[model samples]
Structures are given as C-alpha cells and as structure tokens.
Target: MRIQSTKQLPSLNELKEILSQRFSGQYSVKTFGAGRKSILVGKSTLIGAEISIHKNEVSIASSPPSVFGGILMTLGMTELALFIFPFFFKHKSGYRTLEREIGLFLQHQYC
Candidate 1:
C-alpha cells in the first residue's frame, strides 16, 4: 500500500490504522528525523518513507541488513555456546530430550 501526502501526511495513529489493515498485525509506527523523513514499523522492523522529502510520497521496502546483523550480535557468545555445547559434548540424560524441548518451544512461539 502507498500513501502520497501533499502536506506532511497524517498523524501516526492514522498511519497505523492503514498499515494494520494492510499488514494484518499489531504494529507500532513512528516517524523519525527533523522532517519526519522516515517511517518505522517496529513489530517487523520494516521501514517505509519517501525518497525525497520534497516529494511527500512514500514507498515500502525491505529492511536493512544491519537490523538482522545487530540481532545476531546481541545474541552474544553464551547463547551460541549453549546451542553448540550440547552437540559437541555427550550428555548422560540424552540429547534428544533437550532437542525436543527446544523444538517444541520454538514451534509454539512462531506458529
């Protein structure tokens, strides 16, 4: 969906309603910079905005790679170690049980 505004565009609440109907999810929208140059969709980290502020017309595009890269960095080394430790170290309790529990939790959260 695209919105073209001759005047600065509607408020955030108005934009959120339009996006909610279009995207079908709970979303948080915010405009950033001095001219409100960028519109950020917090839930999915997707960004939509006009390429030129003078144009007052917006476009939607895929999020930047830095967002995903930051997430990977924030996971830190400990979480990575926990995930790999089970694979390299033999467990007396059995690896299948731990693996199953992790898989179930991920499925429940994502699906």
Candidate 2:
C-alpha cells in the first residue's frame, strides 16, 4: 500500500474504502501525526490499533480485550507492529529484515 501525507483526515467512507482494500476486511482508518490507526468495522469488534513514528523507530499497538486477554493483546500488538514497520521505518532493507530477525529469534527456544 502506498501512503500519502495529508493535512486533513479523510472522511469515514474514504477511510473505510482504503482500509478495506489494504486489510481485506471491514476496517476503518485514522491518522495521528505520522501514524495511522485502524479499527475493525463491525460493532463491538474491539480490535483497537495505533501506529506512530518517533525518531527512527516505528511503534504500534493493538489491544483488544478477549477471553484470553494477555495472549490476544500480545498478538494484536505484534500484528500492528509488523503491518506498520515498513511504512514508518526508513531502513533500506525494510520489514523483511525485521521478519528474518524475528524468525531467527523464534527458532531458538530455551524451553
């Protein structure tokens, strides 16, 4: 997805269309400074998300309370981070580097 900078936020219909195309589901988009936040477009979805670019780091959070709250929270946050990393971070290698790093880390387990 190509992201363009805009001083004014897009209308909900516009936002919804953009997000639905990007996420391939019912979704809505919001912007905060250099960040883009999104939410699932159904009632009581509870899939909250936020993304921000600060210094050289991209930060993202998606906290949705579920029956297994902690696990869902962690998964949401990780998904948000992965989705936004390429956009916010300026590294030449892009998110593929981050994905590989994470994969290697996951490959080694203490347990």
- In terms of TM-score, the best-performing candidate is 1
lDDT of 1: 0.40
Model 2 C-alpha lDDT per residue in residues 1-111, reported as the tens digit of each score? 112232343443454455456545433444432223433222123443343333333333443323353454355468685764554344324334433332232233101
Distance (Å) between predicted and true CA of 44, model 2?
5.4
| Candidate 1 Cα deviation (angstroms), residue 86 | 18
Q: Where does the lowest 10-residue lDDT sum fall in candidate 2?
A: 102-111
After TM-score superposition, the amount by which residue 72's alpha carbon in candidate 2 deviates from its true location, in angstroms, is 17
Poorly placed runs, candidate 2 (over 4 Å): 1-21, 32-44, 63-111
All candidates: TM-score: 0.31, 0.27
Q: What does candidate 1's lDDT look like per residue over 1-111, in tens digits? A: 233554554454465455445445443445544766655543332222211222454444333223563354345345685665553344323333433332343233323
Q: Candidate 1: misplaced stretches above 4 Å?
A: 1-25, 45-56, 64-111
Clashing pairs in 1: none
What lDDT does the true structure give each of the candidates? 0.40, 0.37
Model 1 CA lDDT for position 3: 33
